[model samples]
Target: MNGGGSCSLGSVLCVITGASRGLGKSLAWELCSRVMPGSTLLLVARTEKALQVLAEELTLKYPGITATWVAADLGTGDGVRRTVQAAHEMNGQDTAQRVIIVNNAGSLGDINKYFVDFTDPQEVDKYFSFNVSSALCLTSSLLKVFQGRPGLQRLVVNVTSLAALQPFKSWTLYCAGKAAREMMFRVLAEEEKDLRVLSYSPGPLDNDMQEEVRTHTKDPDIRQQFLIMKESGKLIDCHVSARKMLDVIQADTYNSGDHVDFYD
Candidate 1:
């Protein structure tokens, strides 16, 4: 509580990306339920309709909560600018609320081709843009808001995956992007004294991304591995996974630059 006010739900401003569906949607709901009165939520996603739907739903569910959304693509520079602008506008400068940025939006880039054999440079760039560059841009943008506000706590939670720590065939782009994001945060944590950054791996969850892994893979073994997780009832529901992740965020046991898995 360096900001003189207690770290209550009301004093926290949450910025969540990739919040249209899947774990992003689930995490939005969880935060809605937990945030205190006067808390504001800024959700970023590509689908305008979905963001509007969520905004309407949250308004109805929690009448007192303030929620806003930016319908822009995180994979592009312009979209990233629009998202940061919207967040900055919604998150007033005068407010002493601690800022929480959750970089949750990501893509499982081209799974059909081997990384070495994949020659489409455009596709490679896109994968990196979605998974790594976008997160970096958004995080850097928000850091501007806290430049002079040392009293306010700045927390960044970058949703990562097991692929960041291990290699997989045909998953070179995805794995490398995740690793880059984690390392970026590790460096950010070391550089900032008042900021707390977490590179959190949510583990295997029953989400659209996992479904893509099961169906979109060219490798039979990779497909079968995800299939086994699904068939064995081992895939965690997005809501449950989100709750566990929140537990880690709330517990705040790890140091500022640490990487944590859901299982850990």
Candidate 2:
């Protein structure tokens, strides 16, 4: 309002991991419209180029919206620290009325292998490091930075899947990771009464991960089902799912620890 430029000092602080593409990317766009002028979005991903491009796009398209990108592997402790530090130092933090942390960074794991084939301890631990541990540590650290402010609304969303509830033939790692991550947030919701926690299962999305399932899934039946979904054009669009999630947040009626699926 002072300089006459399009940008404004945003007050909403949103941090999204795995934000380079898919649902995370769509969330960035969807959230931009919902927040008032001067809202900030911190995008986290391992690809620097993708993050940079996204940040520029968000900033350019949405007036008064500030989009920042952090390219780092959230699997490591150092990466978690760097991201938390960046969030703590982000400008206009004092003005923020709301904080959103979306723990969406995850992997399908080695889908080509069956359960018995996954024998190595290091391999299992590595899979869990990124898909499971990263979300836990990163969310806890950011909470410490943004906590203790009265009237400051804090929301944490864990991107989960049906695999958490049901077993898939060759997706042991992915299933276990989703289940563990969902449970973690459920526990958080119980421990932190002020925080709103959501375990959202976006369903089978029409994205790169679905493509991987169609091609690399070791279970013949599961692969065939995914292939059918692709062939029949049944996979859910990322934007559509993102919108549903945004609607859920705005509605704010569900129990904090409940698992809400796209169909639900």
Candidate 3:
């Protein structure tokens, strides 16, 4: 685990999308304890109730760290604006020397439909708006706000998937979106030499999303695969994957923008 369990990410302004549940929620838990006292946690997600609960719990547990929650759908332009504005609000904390933007807001996107059903442009656009476009815009804007300080460090993490590299029969939109976001972060890493970027595939997490895949995926083979993973207790725990991601960040060994899978 390296020093992930003990090391500090310094006083950080950490922004995590999809912070309401699953891996994002777990990441918030792990990061809140690891960052320095004055660190700020800006948690963003579509559900205000969930975000509020998470924010309150974290702040109450870690009184020294400020936890701010912004409830917005990252798919819309206004949602991205609201989130970036919140980041700007937190930027006054000059004590924060590191900024970690975890871009984890994305959807499964019609797992019941195969590629042949993906004929509607609006449907495709909607999927990309949330999965690909929003991430690119949010990450870029946040990076600018967190950038320019000579000593400040920035890490952008894309919660990507095996579908980004491999094809799933019923997950046409999802696979395309993941691939697009992964490439986007890779390009960003190349353009900004100082920033750290990672595309982490957390494996088949035993969560709601996995349950959806198991029950609704159009392809019987793929659906059966997910079912087998769940039944056999082979799916990775969200917290386990989250901790490993933090460990990887603390280790800082992987080349920037590289894709690191849970198994890897």
Candidate 4:
């Protein structure tokens, strides 16, 4: 530990969203393998069963790391509170000197019929709430806990997308949500000097979300774009993406508010 703490990495605490599957799940395993022995993981997701299974697997595989989880619907205020409370409980009065928050959970909501769903209020709300609002709420809540430590290093990784940067017709809502999330972190980075925020694009992956996006699009061009990637085997593996992400974030010169692509 850098701050005269007994635990190396200063009693690291990682709070990860969407921990049950996809990049989130891979990140949990990747972090456990990389971080110090005394690190603690707080996994968040909507499904309890999946989280429980992951917790057991991580605890068994990486006995040095402690794992806990809170299953909550991330699109709601209650979900944010529950996640914060779970992190506090896991902290157990002795907080970690180093905290990492990975905001990985997001939604693509009605990508196929972007125009048809344009009038749907609930769809729009869900897209923003889950993709942008949830991350903001969680980060704000945890900042209070991580601040004022003797040698605190607080880092936030906002899982971003190409949709955020490139304008894709059928993915209007998806693009907007990701873009908003990235900008939020960019602003946060400017305000919080001690907090390091990185908007990371993991590149395309062969995940459930990809499958959904491929099938939902009525637009031939949009559908074919995804189809070509799948057929061409261009999608990155979840575990490989996870490993590279950890490496990139741990780089000595990695700065706050960096818009990093996996290839970079």
TM-score ranking of the models? 3, 2, 1, 4
Candidate that would win on lDDT: 3
Per-residue CA lDDT of model 2 for 171-201, tens digit only, reads: 9999999999999999999999999999999
Residue 144 in model 4: lDDT? 76
List residue ranges in candidate 3 displaced over 4 A. none
RMSD of each: 3.4, 4.5, 1.0, 3.7
Show model 1 residue runs off by greater than 4 Å. Answer: 1-10, 148-150
**Order of candidate numbers by lDDT, starting with the best:** 3, 2, 4, 1
Between candidates 3 and 4, which one is better according to lDDT?
Answer: 3
Q: Give the TM-score of candidate 4.
A: 0.93
Counted clashes in each candidate structure? 0, 3, 0, 0
TM-scores, all candidates, are: 0.93, 0.95, 0.98, 0.93
Worst-scoring 10-residue span by lDDT in model 2: 1-10
lDDT of each: 0.82, 0.87, 0.90, 0.84
Task: Using TM-score, give the best candidate's number.
Answer: 3
The residue-by-residue lDDT of candidate 3 on 8-87, one tens digit each, is 67778899999999999999999987888889989999899999999999989988999998989898999999999999
